[model samples]
Target: MVVEEREITVGGDARPARFTSYDVEDFPVPTGREEEWRFTPLKRLKGLLKGADADGKVQIDVDGLGDGVTVTSIERDHPLVGSVLSPVERISAIAFAGFTSGTLISVAKRAVVEQPVTVTLRGEGGTAYGHLVLDVGDEASATIVLDHSGSATYAQNVEIRVGANASLTLVTVQDWARDTVHVGYHAALVGRDARFRSFTVTLGGDLVRLAPTVRYAGSGGDAELHGLVFADAGQHLEHRTLIDHETPKCRSRVAYKVALQGEGAHTVWIGDVVVRKAAEGIDTYELNRNLVLSEGARADSVPNLELETGEVEGAGHASTTGRFDDQQLFYLQSRGIPAVEARRMVVRAFFAEVIAKVPVEHLRDRLTGQIEAELEGSGV
Candidate 1:
């Protein structure tokens, strides 16, 4: 119930939103009616706070992903930028005060970078405010790709920091441009024996919301999260994740795969794991899987766990949603191999263990050609 923290100005520099000095408060408020943000369709999150007090500007196009990626205009008190003005940042701040000059993609400590650092957020008009900060030091290693395809319409905020015994591999591809409207927020911090890996591939967008948060503060830390999403016909794809072990010999893992086709497509998945209480020797796991090819496509899966104290050594969570298994499509149409390439070879073997952990082989063959063009427009 403490909401009086507002000073946030970008290109001319200003700061007051301390995000409660990182503990972030507001009486535990972060609602989409809770329950892990209840199926994530908050009327498209009320149009991202309706223009964040106007004064809009979003037109930036930098061609041919080249040369250590440089585009700098920071100085809104630039010390790795800031925002998330409490009220628990309206439950995970998504473009809080519309952006005013940002783009700081860095890598320079033990620098072992071989290509693979592409950040593309091409938007023109409407609402486009983005903030990105990625710094990986200490024994450094890197691979980062964030591509929000052309034809802009937007709200995006991203923050990433991984140092101390550092290692980071991040890949996010949101195929934007279908009269776009997107709200995104990603925050990650991992240190001391650090290792962080995240991969998300979402096909096209009409209305998309993605919130990815990961924190494993030191103590032999490690974290890995993988996700693949495919939504067709008048699309809507939403994903929310948070895995925090907060110290004491940490480790985390999460896996997500979703597929839905045709008529007003919608796919939603939420996975959250938190083990606090000083996180004694923790180890965590979470999983969610869904497949519903047609019949007016739709899917929803929720996996959550919160353990304050249990002197944790291991923890678990899981969820599943079903469809597409008419006896494995009649045993592949009785073996003549004609049931549309055997249902695209069983949805690519149920998405080949999250696309074989995509360490960039042409972005895993361009995400397996957008999952076989959504199974040939779902005639399969």
Candidate 2:
């Protein structure tokens, strides 16, 4: 339960952190008493709260990158860096201030690309602050892959702008060293009639906390947020997400699946959706599911929905947290499948729907392998 609900202020004299503000000072440092920080374990965040420095210990490598996709670096003050999005939390503000430079990836307007843009980030051990922006131009379509690895304390802000009528599929894999700590905020701006799909697969890390927020710039935009988190013994992984239906007739759906195995494993999923009064006829739904694979593991699921209009076509939310389906497992075993193999089949089936949505084949195969490895009890 939240401590106090009446303490939040907006505008005028003193305003608490409004979801729309950009100023870092507008948001107070979370003391775990606030609604947003209640489920998060802030003590494990290292120093991202006080403004962690970017030590240049993170190395970025691009592979299979093609032309027409330009990568440019700009100073933090660049007008285009945060033009579409502003930090809504203290960690995001601190990250923007501490980052050495901002990376911008631009796709030409109306340009169609066949190859996927791939970027590999390896942390060389130290504290790092980062900023990444992906701007998909109007009527353009592309796939982006962001892979993170190695050891470090990393905090960053990611902003993605999906232009009018553009379609984008972005895959982010957090495969870090066990000692790594990552805290980042990802915000996406979806334009009119545009489609944006994001897949986040988190596998390896000592502690990983990711926040993804979405809002519509125009009507008829469709946004889908799909995430999968697999946590093994002693690993802490959390995902907090929000989708704001600000435009009429916009559609949005969010589904996050988590699997926890072994002792000391913890996973958290928080999903919130707000349909403003102006957003008439907006359709939205959010669902969070957790599967505990073993003893001494924990999964926390929360789904919140705020509707300000009664004219919406459809609006709802759902959450489910429990162990594996024993009946299904028994049926699989009775069909002559080995116990381990049967369990694997059920787990794969649980995740296959989301993984199949990945537009890239090689990337899908890679994610499948990681999931299989996790099911097989492989150590990170």
Scored by lDDT, the top model is 2
Mind giving the per-residue lDDT tens digits that candidate 2 earns over 54-92? Answer: 664778766665666888887877877777667667877
Off by over 4 Å in 2: 1-26, 378-380
Q: What stretches of model 1 exceed 4 Å from their correct place?
A: 1-77, 82-127, 132-152, 160-179, 188-205, 209-211, 218-233, 240-264, 268-280, 287-294, 298-312, 315-317, 323-380
Clashing pairs in 2: none
Model 1 lDDT, full chain set: 0.71
Q: Which candidate tops TM-score?
A: 2
Worst 10 residues of 2 by lDDT: 1-10
TM-score of each: 0.32, 0.92
Q: What local lDDT does model 1 show for residue 60?
A: 47
